[model samples]
Every structure is written in C-alpha cells, then in structure tokens.
Target: MPKIKDKAIIIGVDAVLPALLAQGVSPHFITSIDPQKLTYEKIADSADQIKDVSLIAAPYVTPEVHKIFPASNIFWTFSTKSIESWINSMLEGKILTSGASTCAHLNLTAAIMMGCSPIIYIGQDLAFPEYRDHAAGVVLSDPDQIKKELGVTNQNTVWLDGVSGGKVPSTRGFLSMRNHLEHIMASNPGPHYINATEGGAHIAGTEVLPLQEVIDRYCSETIEFPSRLHTALQDSNLSNTKKLLSGLNKALNDTKSLSKTVNKYDKLIHSILHYIRSENNNGAARSVSDLPILLQNKISNAESLEKKMDNRKHLYIWQILGEGTMEDVKKSECSLHEITILAKQPENFMLSFTKNLERLLSLNKARKNILAMFQHRLLHIINFHRKEKIILKKIEQKKNMEQNLFELAQFYFETGNLVLAQPVLEKLLALNPDSAEVLFYSGAIAARQSKFEESEGYFQKAQEADTAMSKRVLEFRRGLGGIYFDLAGIQEDKIYSNLSRKMLFKGIRYCSNHPKIKQEIIYLAESDLTRIKSALESGTINDVETILTVWHKGLEENKNLAPCITDDQIAGFHRHYGELLLKKGDLDGALKSMQAALKFTPDNPDLYATAAELFFAMQDFTNGITHLNKAVELDRSYAILWENMGDHLLQTGEINDAIAAYEQGFIAIPENINLLKKIGDCYLENGQLEAAREAYKIVKEKYELAQPPRT
Candidate 1:
C-alpha cells in the first residue's frame, strides 16, 4: 500500500467506479456527456460509489444533484471553439476535464492540472474488438461480409451526426475521440501516463494489466456491504417479497453486494437454459446470413446522404457569392447566417459584386431567372460527372494494359490496398492465356480463399508457360517457380515439401545469372526448410545444411548483391545465420559472422545501437562506443541511439562528457534508461551526491515503475 500522495490519479469511466471505490482510491473521474441526452442526475446517481466526480458537460443537472455537488467539483468544457469563453471561465484549475477524443487525452489534461506524478488509466476500452456502431443499442456485425455484399469498400463504419445525440451513431464519434486523445498526449508533456488494462487497442508507452487480474482486484478489494436502507427494511418485518425488493434497491448502492444478486439469479439462469433447450434452436443461425444485406442498405443510405449534403454545401457557397454585393459583404461579418441570407437571393449579391450585372439583367426574363437560381448548381453537377467519367475511363485503360501489367499490379499490391490489384490481375490474365506471372499471383489470391484446385491449376499452367517461353526462358521459369512455391505455402498435401524443393531447384537453375532472382530463390528455400524440420521428424539435416552452405558460398563470391540489398533484409539474414550457428555450438563462428554482417552495414542505426550487447558479451567497451558513435552519426533521429552511446561512455569512465552526452540524448529521446543511469553515474563521479540522487530518483519514479512499451 503506497501513500495516497505518492500514488497516481487513475482516470476511468463507469466500469471502474466499484473497483476504485473498493481500494479507497479517491481518483478524479472525468465524465463524458452526450449533449442530447444530458442528464446530470442520472450520471451522479450511477457513480454514487465514488467520493468525487468531475463533470465536463453535466447535461443540466437537477436542483437536488446540483446542491449535492460543490461548485468546484464540476467544470464546463467543450472541444469546439464556439464555447471558448465559457469553458475558460468555468474550467480553470479543474483536476479533471473531458476532451473530444479518447479519455486518455482527457486523463492527460486532468493529470497536468493536478500536477500528478503519473496518470494511470483503468477501464480504458477505446474501441470494440469487432466492428460495432457506437450507439447505445446498435448491434454488432461482420464488416467484411457487409463490404462484399455492398460491392464497395468502407473503412469507417460509423456516421456520427454533428447534431444533438438524436442521430443514429456512427464511427465519427469514436475516430474524433481517438484523434483528440492522440493530439493532447502529443502536445502536452508532464505526468507520465500508463494504461493498466489489456482488453483494448494498444497505446504506446503504456503498461497493460491482464483483464482477469483487474476483475479479481475489483472483486477482492472493493467494499460492498449491505446499504442502510436494506437494514431498516429488514428490521421492519416486511413481507418476504417486499424484503427482497428492498434488498435489491439497497444493493444498488453497495458495489460488492451485486455479487449476491448475481448468485440469486442462478435459478433463473437454469430456467432460461431449460426453455432454450425446449424451444427450437435453428432460428438464430438462419437469420445470421441476412445481416450483411441489411448492413449494405444502411451503408448505401448513409453514402447517399453524404453526397446530398456535399451538393447542398457547394451550391450554397456559389449562391452566397453570386448574390452578395462587394461592399455589403465586406461590411458584414462572415458567418453562416449571413451566407444563408445571400444564398436565397443570388441576384441581389450579383448586382453589386459583378461588373456584368447590367448585361445579366438585359437577358430574357425567364432565362435570367433560371440562370440566377440554378445555373451554378447545374454546372457543378456536370463537372462532378465529367470527373467520374474520366476515372472510369482510366480504370478501363488500366484493365487493358498488356506488357506493363505486372509492374502496375505490383505497385498496387505493395501498397496494402489489394482491391484494385486483384481486379488488375484478373484483367491481365484474360489478355495473356499463358502468363506465368499473372497465373502465379492469381493463384496466391485463390489460395487465401481456400480454392486449392484453382491454385493448383494456375501453378500447372505457369509450369507449361515456362516451358514454351523460349525467348524469355529465365523470367518465365522464375515466375513458374514462384507459383509452385506459393502453392507449397498454401497446400497441406503430402507432396508439398517435394514440390517446394523441386520449385526451389528449378528457380536456382534458371536464375544462376540474375543475382536478385537467386537471392529470392535462396530466401524462399530457407523459409521452406524451417517448416520442413518442424513437420517431418525424419527429414535429413544435410538437406538444410546444404542450403545454408550454398547461401554462404554465394554471398562470399558475390559483392554486388550484398551492397544492393536492403538493410532490413541484410539484418534478417545475419540474425538467422547467427541463430543457426549458435544452435551448432559455434559461438565464435556466430560472433564473427554477425560482426561481418554488421561491418557491411556499419552505418545502420538499429544495428549500431544493439552492438553494445554483442560487445558486452565479448567484454569490450572500446569497440562498443566506436560503433555507437557511428550509429548516432548515421541516424541521429533514432530515440535509442543516444541512450546506448550514453551507456558506453559511462562504462569507459568518461565522467563529464558522459553526463553532457546523456543529457543531450535524453532531451532527444525521453524515458531512456541508459541515458538516465549514465547521467546519474556521471554526477556521482563528479562528487555531486545530491544531483546524482535526484537524477536516480527521477529515473526510478518515471521509468522503473512505468508500464512496458507496447506494440
């Protein structure tokens, strides 16, 4: 049990009330309110377990609730700039306040105001595990199925109405919440923040506690004895039924007492189970298939509304400009109301604003009236349609491209936007009947969909195509080999290993002259060998050793291929090779091979930063600092580089310079241990005992007890 002042303020919502109260934790609760359903009394009543509650926008609390809360306990706030004056006046120095985004942001704001040491979050469930609309009663459904049925891709499923909460909720509110949280955390720096729950999306720099642990903490530590009302009612000798009802009402205030109610419901659960068994069970499954279509209609309607609103906004803009007089508009304040007024009378604004107004007035009465009201609107619609037409034509042209289809398809594929790439491949295959490249990729897609025969057919066609492509024999064989390798990756057939080996052999034979192709072939062969060892106990170790030996020999013989490779790829190869050598008990060999790989990429920041571990293993600090300095010079932007360098400096006994370097590095990258420890050691070396102690204390307070960094 830590002292109350030493502990962090825990920010949470309704789910955490019982748990926090049980721990005697008097944390500041920041309530998020829906303006349309604003009712201060309801929230206050629900959160009765807590001693204090801070309201951001207390939906107009009733007189009773208002009287109960001290004026300082509540604060009025809004994310929109429209209420800036009111917010500033009402919310000054409030310990907790809500923001437009995630509660994390609001919690960070609250932490800053309190000058708390660290902000820890509980019950910070930011997003749902599955696609769900963010309304009270919206049912969850599969978003993938909905996209397929609608024949369109929709990344965002929610359509949050900007009006009062009466509109059907959409993802807009959730995204706005997430965006707001990120912005506040990025902008403000004071108290450290950590999330203590794992059942939500991962937030950086936060520690995650298991959900079961949280649940246990809530159950074991929270105070939930029977309420005062229950005792009075029981002593009155009321009827059994009346006593039961009284107990239920009293239990609402006692968070722990809810378990008794749950226990009492066991009989009811059994009865419901009996009824479910007696009744028909097929109804639920039958209706599940229809959910996608229902979602499609909702999505379509929302899209239509969005288009209509865009049109209205554009037309209104043109209408305001057409009608406004230059002097009248210049004299008037720019506001939505003034623009609306001008929109209804385009001619009045045009008469003063345009030099051609006199000629416009000379036109025929009917034509002039029509042009004044709707000419711009018609032109806007026509222009939009023309743009759509151009896009459609490009799509068609993309489908018709012949020789360059592979490159074009690859461009789309690498972007992680597969919708367009899939169709492009489909079109390219239609034009070229024996295209091994198209067949191989198409087969990969089919494999993902579990169309095994179709994948096999594509691989077979690729093999045939390779044999016939005499002029482009090397390219065709490589493509065919790739298709076979993919087929091996997907198929669970007994012959998959044999097929994979043959494919690798074929690719190596054809790609002997092409270093890039040879590199890919070797990489794929290595990957298959890893799986083969695990799946087949009797598999020959010689088979794997031969592949490794050949790869090493090839690299030693080829220098051009080594320099041309990506840093990540080189790092991956070195890591795997080192691991393999270590498994063979060849530690020195492993160290040498890893060092050689590092020498080839000495300027790689990630490699340099991690070099200390290797040097430390070898009991050498001199080389470590040299490598770290190179790392810092190569990538000054990496947060971990300076931290590693600081450690190396401290190890070598460079007291004064180490302190300066650590301070500079820590300024660049916060929450780094090497810099913190090195700075403290530097202070100790210089006989500044107090400064050393303070540096160590700050590091312990902020980093030692901080949550692990998340993915």
Candidate 2:
C-alpha cells in the first residue's frame, strides 16, 4: 500500500475517518450525510487530524460538522433530491452525488467521481462478523454497540454466502447497502471493482482478494495525486469566488429572506399543534377551518419566496435544510394528509413535527450563518486574485478611499459579515456622519447586532438627514420590527408586541407605496399581538391557540381586503378540516365539509385517502377497497396506503385482489423486502406453489445478506 500511497485519491466517510487517521492514512477527501448532531460528534475528536481533508457534504449535514472543516475545503454532495437546476448555475463548485444512507456507498461514490480506478473495498463487511460491529480503533455509542436491539433472532436471521466460502449472517439494512453498491458498480463501466475484505458476505460484481495481494498487484507505481488535486481546486475556487460572492450577498440582503419561510412554516406547525390542543375546548373558533388557511403559505408562500429570487425557484437550499417544512410545502395544501389526522396522534405527531421543524430551523439558520462564513472566506479568496495596482492604488485619494471603503462595507454587510463590516462602517461614519446611506446601514447593522436603542437613534438621524430616504428608512424600521417581533414570540410580552407594532406602523406610514406592508398584514400581526393592545383593539384574544386562530381568521376575514388570500385558499381550508373530521369520527360534519370542498373542487385525493382508511378501520372492506382504488388511481406512489388496501383485501377473502395490491405496494416501496414474503404468503394461500416458491426464493436471498445485528 505504501508503494502507491501518492498514486490514489483515497476518500473516507465520517464513519471510517477516525480509523483511517489512526492508521496514519491521510485520505484526500471525506464524506458526511447524516443530519443529526451525532453525525458530527462521531468523529469530532479527530477534527485537528483532518483539517486539510476536503469535505463532501450534503446540505443536510449538521452545521457543526461544516464549521469544523475549512470553508474552502467543503464541497456539495447530494442525495438526488430535485434541487432547482439553477442552483448549479450560481456556483462553480463540482457537485457530487452520494448514494442514499450508507457511509461505504458514499465513499465509493466519492472515489469514482475522482476518477479512481480498480476501486478496492477494505473492511467492507456487509455482515457483523463474529458479533464485532467495527474494527479496533472505532468507538461506537452504547446503544449502537448493543446487539439484541437489532431484533436478530435465529428464525429471523438470513445467512449470506461469505467471501471465504462459509455462510454469513446479515440483516435487511446491510443487504440493502450491498445491493446499492452492486448497482453502482454495474452502472459505472471501466472501474475494476475489488473487495479486499476476505471476511464478511461476498459482494457480487467484484473480485475478492486479500488487501495485501490486491495492493501488490495494483500498486506497482506511484502517481502524484496531492499536487494534482490541489492545483485543480485552486483554479476552481479562484474562478468562482467573485461570482458566488454576488449570489451569497444577494441572499443575505433579501428582506423576504429565507427567514420569512422559516417564520411562516414555524407558525404553521405551531398552529397545527395548537389546533390539536384546542379541539377539547369545544369553542376554539367556529372556524375549525383555520388550519388550511394557516397552511396556505407552506406551499404558496414558499414558492413565492423562490420566485422572488429573480423570479426563479432559487431556494433549493430549503430542499436540504427544512426537510419537514419543505415536504409539506412541496405538496399541495389540500392534499397534505400525511400529518392531518392529529386527533389520533396529537402528542406523537406534535412532538415529531416540532422536533423536525426545530432541526430544520436550526439548519436553515445555520445555512445563513454558513453562507456568511463562506462569504467572508470568498472575499479573502477574491483578494488573492486582485491586481494590487488596479484595486488599491487607484482608490488612494481620501474621497475615493471613502467611497470605495463604503462600497466594500456594503458588500460585507449585504453578505452578513457584520464583524468585518462593523469596523468599515465605523470608519465611514467617522468620514461622513451625516451620510444617509451610511447612517441607514449603521442602523441596520445595529438592529441586527441587538443594539436596538442605538439602531433607533441611527434610523432617526438617517431619516432626519434625508427626508427623501423613505424606502431605506422603511427597511430600517422593518428590521427593528423583526427584532421586536421575534422577541415577542419568545417572551409573549406586551412590551415587545407594542414595540413591534410601533416599528411596523412606522414602516407602513413612511412608505405607503410599498404594497406588501399592508394594513392587513399589520392587522394580521395585531391578531398575533398580546391581549393587552391588539386584543383590546381587534378583540382577538391572546393565548397560544386563540392567537393563531385569530391570526388565520384575520387572513380569511380580510380576503377581500388583502391580495394574499383567495377563494381557492378558503376551499383548501374546508378540505383539510373534512380530512381530519373523517379520522375524528364526525361523519356528518366530514360529509358536509367534504361536500363543501368538493363543490369548490371535486375528487380530492387526500379526501379519498382519509375516507378509505376510515372505512377500512370500521370493517367496511367493500367501500374501503373502492375508495383505496380511487386514491391509488390519483397517486400510486403511496406504498403504505397500498399495503393498507392489500391487508384489507387479504382479510376479506379477496386473494387475487390482495396479491395484486401487495405487488403494487412492493413496486411502490422496494426498500421493504419483507413485502415479497407477504406476496409469497398470499400466493401460497391461493395454492400457487411454484409462484410462492419463486417469490420466497428472492426474498430469502436478500434477507440472508446480513446478520441480525451489525456488530
């Protein structure tokens, strides 16, 4: 292996990073995918050991992990999510796609993308051999190190054909990983795939040999990989730095920033939680349809935010960070029944949704911070490419220097480099304290930095300095409004609410031409305001559920007054309410609501799914399957729904229909290999011995690929 250490561009996933570093093998690149902070904690002890290794990361990677790596060293890795194609056009970095879920698969993917040949898999055990999960250097968490929790039993276990000729015990997860590796090898031609781990389950489509022997044959000569890669990266970063800087700057400068999406979705999830809690009150509102109106922004507003990005869906970032919220937003509001039935799972669904949103909120906020870090680093990179004579010498005059430095401060401020922009803006204020642009920027900077009093003074001064600076003053006031607004959400204090309203009203009054800062949205915010002020004036009560209830009620009541609300949105509200009512056992209410919804737009798929499950649970198989068929006709990708249909059919002596539904379920979700066994059982029950035998055979082969527990 030492003979060609320089020849290969070895890459390791975060799983194998510690072991590799311990072995003194400095891999050129590392891959990371898991979103949990645990993914970062796993190899954090070795942060110093791998500062130079490039990170190939998905946007879902925990922000902590991104922070540990050098800003210039990190590159994007994706899980094949449908990111808006325009995202690639904005960055010059080479985007790498990682296979789903496993460390080894991602490593292999990273290697192949780097033009590596004869891909050798080392310690690639698709089985937990001898009940040992990892090699000597790796320290696993306590739960992961335990065996029985994996549900591996002798009866449940399937044996795999091993590399050294004996059978190996394996599990469903490792078996899936093995198949994924095989698929990659099959699809990508010209890479000589070799498995160097002489123990563990055998991988098809690869030659198996001992590591030493494979190295002896393949590593006869050395090639300079480090300098080659370093040179290539230098060229890429230099060419792309300035262009990417502009995009990053614009994103941070956005008022309808990604934060708006976060605020909207956070409210939606909270509104759902509140609605579930309010159901017992018997009088939360006559408008139980508040949910869908609250839900309207999850899709429409998010798409609006994306379109506002130069009128394009530029926020593929949401696809990465805000998975739960984005998934809801991606679906049509009326069809989002995935979490609609809260009456059955109020606590569980609320906890899961809130936790997921919390993670997404952290990740989204983290991305902005990450982009700021990237922006700061890119500025440094751009400086390296600057022609000193052209850039510095020409701006040497006092006046010219002030203008140039002010522009430079604006760049820094726009991309959220407040720390750097602080000193520059201070210098500009020193040069021209009365400059409205400079004062307005100072006010914004102070507001974001939480110096609210100082920010207020700066905004007042800026306004006084130039009576014509209404738009900038309006924006400055809005910034102040946002800070107070957030504080109000956290503390639920009337002081913060009043202050927020004061700033928002000031913004609206100063720039009446700005269409978005309407009295309706302000009143909507008032509906969200405390019992003291907004509640006193608008008669909208303040409490968790009532605050949200009135908020949507305001949106609905002002539909004719506000451009944002419409008739279709109101219908979507009824659909969601009916969908939940079906689950809640209010059949008459559901039928009325459903009919109202159908009148606006007939044959809603979510309505069909809700009714189908309701009927299935009530033992009305004939009607259940009929509704299931209609739902499946509208959307065939719902595997669990298909399984529900199959289970109902199997229970009612419809063997043929049962088998067909199970097959469709299997087609919809190929990950659950156990579905094949269910199909086999149905075939056997129907006395089709040969068909059962074939289906069971395939299931057995896959099931046997891993041990019960991955040691």
Best by TM-score: 2
Report the lDDT tens digits of candidate 2 across residue range 340-405.
443246444444443444444444445455445544544554443353324345457555888788
lDDT tens digits by residue: candidate 1, 1-711: 113312323444422333445556544544443332212223332333445444433323232233322222454444433223232423342223444433345456756665664455544545443322122211111233333333224455553322222222234446566556656666666556555543444445554555344344433433222232245435753334333334333322232232222223333333333433454632242222322454335434434533542354234322323333333433343343454465456444322222222222222232224334443443443444454445556556765457556665665444433434567788788888778877766654443323445655776676677754333444544564454344334343432233243333333433344544455555554464454355335544333443344445435544434443455455545644554676676656666666766766665676665554466456676776666666667776664655555567678887775776688678766657657877887899889999999999988888756868779
Mark the regions of model 1 whose C-alpha exceeds 4 Å error after superposition: 1-8, 14-27, 38-44, 47-72, 75-83, 86-104, 130-173, 205-711
Q: In candidate 2, how many clashes are counted?
A: 9
Model 1, total clashes: 8
Off by over 4 Å in 2: 1-4, 48-52, 69-72, 82-87, 94-99, 141-144, 150-158, 237-239, 248-323, 326-711
For lDDT, the strongest prediction is: 2
Lowest-sum lDDT 10-residue window in model 2 = 541-550
